[model samples]
Target chain A: MEYQRYNCGNCGACVAVCPQQILKLNENQVTKDPGCDECGNCTIVCPLGAFTWKVGHEV
Target chain B: MKYDVVVVGGRIGGSIASLYASKDDADVLMIEKRQEIGTPVQCAEGTTQSIFKILDMKPDKRYINAEIDGATIHAPDGRAIDLAEVSCENFLDGTGYKGYILDRKVFDKHLAIQAAKAGAEIMMKTTVKDLIRKDGRVCGVVAEHLGETMEIKADVVIAADGVESNMARQAGLTNPNKPGNIGSCAQYELFGLDIDPHQLNFYFGREIAPGGYLWMFPKGEDTVNVGLGVRSTKKTAYQYLNQFISRFKGTTPVELNIGGVPLSGPIDKTYTDGLLVVGDAAGHVDPVTGGGIHIAAFCGKTAGQVAAEAVKKENTSESVLKRYDEIWREKFGKNLEISLKYRNAADKLTDKDMNALAEFLEKNKIENLSKISAIKFLGKHPHLLMLIRDLL
Candidate 1:
């Protein structure tokens, strides 16, 4: 998955609400856990709509 | 790029900070990572009129959705108490106290525009990658703007970067929130709502919200912002919001927002060498009410003024900038401390205690009480007093 590099405000609202606890924020970039499932919870919670799933990428 | 002040985050706090700094003749830049200033609204969009007075801003119809005359609190068992009369007496100079539900998108954008007009540069879609520290003092920021990495230098950096502030950590300040200190929230703007247009409604119960309350604030004639906040719950805020929205069978949400609020007091430290933290990043919110817009504006203005003075004096050291903390704390710290005590005590209250408190409000015919007043009233009861003795 490719997150919007410029749009993540680093608010960590996405990290806090992620059900699987797979999203980790390093400064402004969010890294997904290897055990991630694409539940889209992070996307739903990000205030800036910063997260996006790259096509053909499977978690 | 170089500026005297670089304010990260372009919402209310950052914009306001930039506005004051620019007005003080400091070169200022406000950066926001979002494409828009206030898209994907995160709050219930409710605030008191006192905020406008603090900012010396006149109320604009363009961003006001509704003027709330009073509020009604619903007990878990459906008992209701209206607060109109007492609220009027205490807050409104004997006229009715009116809270406002704002169109946050418009309101935030307006504040940013005000900052820009005051000579502050605003850069949207700019994400601060990290703070640029020189000899353990923050001197600038590395940010990504338009897919390009740019290093922006500043004499002072203000972190208005919302709830999860990387700047705070970069400055070596402890996190402002603890596990139970934050409340998860989800809000929905619904149309075709059948409810009182002038009174905000709050519902309290463990089942409804484990450690917080749910609210429905009227937006316009037939619309409302319905939301809930909860802390230390097994259920997600979304689940609680879903269950709460199920009550309004016919109403459909026009907008959905999920966010978090710091329910603790302000952070112990809000200023570091060459850096200042304001607004949600500083946890300048009411613990009991989960309100921060006013506090954010208040602290933002203070930080900006202090930052400008420091810049002019060539003393942006932590010792000099610490005045922002002292001034804000002297102004509003006691209230926040009291709110924290009350929140901690109230969160421990049982469902039975809540029912009893509701009963007391009903039986005593108390129309409204401030958080402190409510705590005092509850303190009068031996049982309730014992429950919250440590807080008292």
Candidate 2:
């Protein structure tokens, strides 16, 4: 999934639905570690549409 | 650092758990990732009076914005069903004060203060990075605060974490919530919106919120919380909220809040060995209404009582902690299950169905809801009969 960080609300919606648990939420920013299986759970749960299915952005 | 219990998150669940656990004389520590207990509020702040009953506290105006006695539900065809005109027999949850709109920013911190007064230690701005496990059983947590990492040991760890909870996942009590089961929501606190200050308004239609609905909750003094939730949709909930907000002129948002609510029923398991899960972490939220404050308070109290008992017994094993699950389930399990069923059935409703139901209910107001009138209404809206049957 491609993350539009600027649009992120830091609501932690992505962190809860991330099956791999790779997402981490900070006070002001949300970060992701490597090893995303790309289940696209974050894409649908985000209130701001921060995460998107980009197919192969940089894989 | 070591304590009898370490509760993650400092919202309704965590603070209540901390308060009850401390009241029972168990050494407790509650951790919060945010510096403040409640800010950037997520909820529409509507909660039943049952929560105050559960907390054994009076409704203090410092945190309560408005007291609502009724609600107005708007259908797709512009029909309105005023719940005040209906009798108690029509309500699914039975008769009581409808609800209260809370200033969560004040309420959350007040609850945390109550926990502190009850002897629970609180650590702010600390995030638990991982759980501390020993011998295949969860024991405590490794947390970070201001770049300092520390491992806090506790006999039992209560995961009162919110929607973004990972402690339960790490302990193997549950998995991530499916997107379909989550209510992706956005709210705006508007400064100048004129409406009934004592009544709640709900708008339902696919165009308003595809999988969910929109709510306009009056927060006293010309302020209101307008929000919506949707699921599995390409358009974000924020966009849906903006479309609905655009209708009211001369209104500007003062604060924008975003959140995700787990609409699934409680998780398969709430406790495993030394760990207990409560609140949104355990999916204690009611699916039909997206409300969890009362459920969280009840479960938090139960978990705290159980945790204290386990500590006194000198055993914090799964066998001892499982009592928490039994107690909360016995109180709310069947209700949540029924609500989830209703939510699933309601998800299938179309604009025509909603308008038909609204029209039917409005005609069957308290004075007109006779036996023959009900039969005639059903005869006219036969499809609604099927829908209600499916819900049941």
Candidate 3:
């Protein structure tokens, strides 16, 4: 998954729903720690559309 | 350090739990990750008057932004249905009105102060990175503050952590929710608005908020909270919010609040040996409307009272702590279950269905609506009857 940091609110909505528990929010920033299956949960729950599919994962 | 109770998260749930435990003569400590208690407001800030009743305290004017008396529900086709003041606590169970819009920044800090006054020690900017488990029971937390790590010991550890909660998962009480079950919310506090300050407004349509609805809650005469919650939508909640706000010609946002609400109802269980989960961590939110502040406060107070009693008895085992689950569940569990079922049925409603329902409501007194009236209404709308037949 890719992130558009400008639109990111760093609210941790992604962190809450991430099954892999790979996303981290600290000091108003969200960072990923790999091992993502592109479940698209972040894309769906994000208020700011900061995350997008990393291509080819599209149905 | 050892304490009788350790509560994670410094929001409404944590503060209320700490307050009650301390008031009950149990030593308590609350840990918060943020530098301040409620710097960035996340909620729409509307809550029922019963919140004050639960706290056993009067409503303080310092944190109340508006005292609401009524509400107007706007349907997709622009039909407005007004609701008067009621005794009901929330929208899913009843209609609307008799509420207050709180300034959470002030309200949260005030709650922390109340906890402090009750002898509960609080630590801001302290993050609980992990729970300390002995054998199979949670008994403490491994926390980090200013890059320094320490293990704080407790007989009962209450997880009041918010939606991004890790403590509850570690205790094996809950799992990550599906995207469809989370309410992705975004809001803006606007400075210029022309609307009834004492009357709340809600706009509904898929084009507006998808699975949820748009709300305008007045904070002051000239300012209002405009927000919306959406679920499983192609467009982001922020995008939808921006689109809705564009209609207002001169309004400018003074603050932006965004967060996720757990709308799947309370978890299956909220207690284990030496562990109790409260607030959003336990999904103590209304599944239909995504409101949890008052519920969190109520559950927090219950957890605190229960934990303090368990501490006095020198037994914080699951057998004893499970009483916490039983108490709150008995009081609120059935309501949440019914709301979840209603939300599922409402999810299938189209704009036409909502408009039709609004039309029915405009002519009829929603407050006096009974099962017979609902059946009669459904008899006319077969499409809606098919969608909500089981719910009836």
Candidate 4:
């Protein structure tokens, strides 16, 4: 299955809805700094479809 | 005055719902009980790096607490399984969002701001009293603002209240949670203990959390969020949580946090005439993991988008709202269902089983525990594997 990635130019749109605060923008690029727990909020919150994961990957 | 949509709760679900509706040019009003967003954080605040792609946004360093390089899994018997492998290539070099720990207060307020920027009106310190139905159909909501009763009419209403969603029940949707389907959690934010910044830990077994688990997510140098969750069955969740919290006696003294997690899947039905329920209020938490943040937002976005479509169609009936259900099933319901099935199987696992599972992890490089990997691992144990296979 095709994975999800947004042509996001480092806009902080997905970061806004993160309950875990995992998604981060560093050096004007989107990054997940250190404290990620795979809550998936960032993926669902992004307006540009920038956050994507393999459907059958490990949870 | 009537609006296109009225969202109760200004949290992620509510805010995202408003954003979706307003994006379609629908007038949306979001109400929050708190003066500020994301205060008194109720979650473990850990999320995968890839979640940002789904939201089309990224967080900054300001909200991040640490970078997790790997996770350590401890079985009921205290055996450990540690994995530092990053499945995503280039993820470690910062080319991709690695993963994050966050400050929810700033994060939640930011979501509210984004919703407003998307043209949704937000009201803080506003509480919904009840759902207004006309002819067995939802038409609006009755709310209290600063002790004053006010009636607001909307073409559609979205319920995003976390757990214990009174609004959903008042709207006539069947309650989806029972004691067996809920998990209670208690945690402490300790500041004095030196913790490994790159390692996250999960301890499991009936002794620590029957049908649940315990976790340690380090925030920074000498700080970590230590907590435990126990399934709410015959034991009252409060009783179990209090006893569990006291176990941190020799560790250190710090802030204490308590909350409940709905392990049941969403209600069989999540829509009614002119109304839709999203997030925890709809019981969309992950059954196996007790994580609801992503599922809730995904539900919220779908609800918001579908509600917008209903407004545009000029049909706010139960049938129209049912479309949201279809959208959710297409996107998240299947995975959630699978997770719940896994949870049921996990619930049947004994402390001995947990010890064996932990030892297995320590022995093998199943690396990260994915649903498929877990199933494959249990394949050798015919009885347990068969049970899980049937459930899955």
Q: Using Cα atoms with residue i matched to residue i, what is each candidate's TM-score against the true structure? A: 0.86, 0.96, 0.95, 0.77
Pairs with backbone N, CA or C atoms under 3 Å apart (clashes), candidate 1? none
Worst 10 residues of 2 chain B by lDDT: B88-97
- Chain A TM-score, prediction 4: 0.58
Compute the interface RMSD for candidate 3. 1.2
Which residue pairs show backbone clashes in model 2?
none
Model 3 C-alpha lDDT per residue in residues B285-371, reported as the tens digit of each score = 998888988889999999999999999999999999998899899888999999899999999999999999988777667577677
- Model 4, position B318, has a per-residue lDDT of 83
Off by over 4 Å in 1: A1-11, A14-30, A33-59, B85-96, B366-382
Task: Give stretches of model 4 more than 4 Å off.
Answer: A1-59, B84-98, B233-254, B366-386
RMSD to the native, candidate 3? Answer: 2.2
What is the Å distance of residue B278 in model 4 from its true position? Answer: 0.5
lDDT of 1 by residue, B70-137 (tens): 88888888888776532235432123467788999999999999999999998888888799999999
Instruction: Tell me which of candidates 2 and 3 scores higher on TM-score.
Output: 2
- lDDT over C-alpha atoms for residue B255 of model 2: 92
Better of 2 and 4 by DockQ: 2
**DockQ of candidate 2, scored on C-alphas against the true complex (2 decimals):** 0.75
Off by over 4 Å in 2: A55-59, B88-97, B379-382
Q: Give the distance in Å from residue A41's predicted Cα in candidate 4 to where it truly belongs.
A: 31
Ranked candidates (TM-score, high to low): 2, 3, 1, 4
Question: Where does candidate 3 chain A have its weakest 10-residue lDDT segment?
Answer: A22-31
**Candidate number with the higher DockQ (1 or 2):** 2
- Give the poorly placed runs of model 3, Cα more than 4 Å off: A55-59, B85-96, B366-376
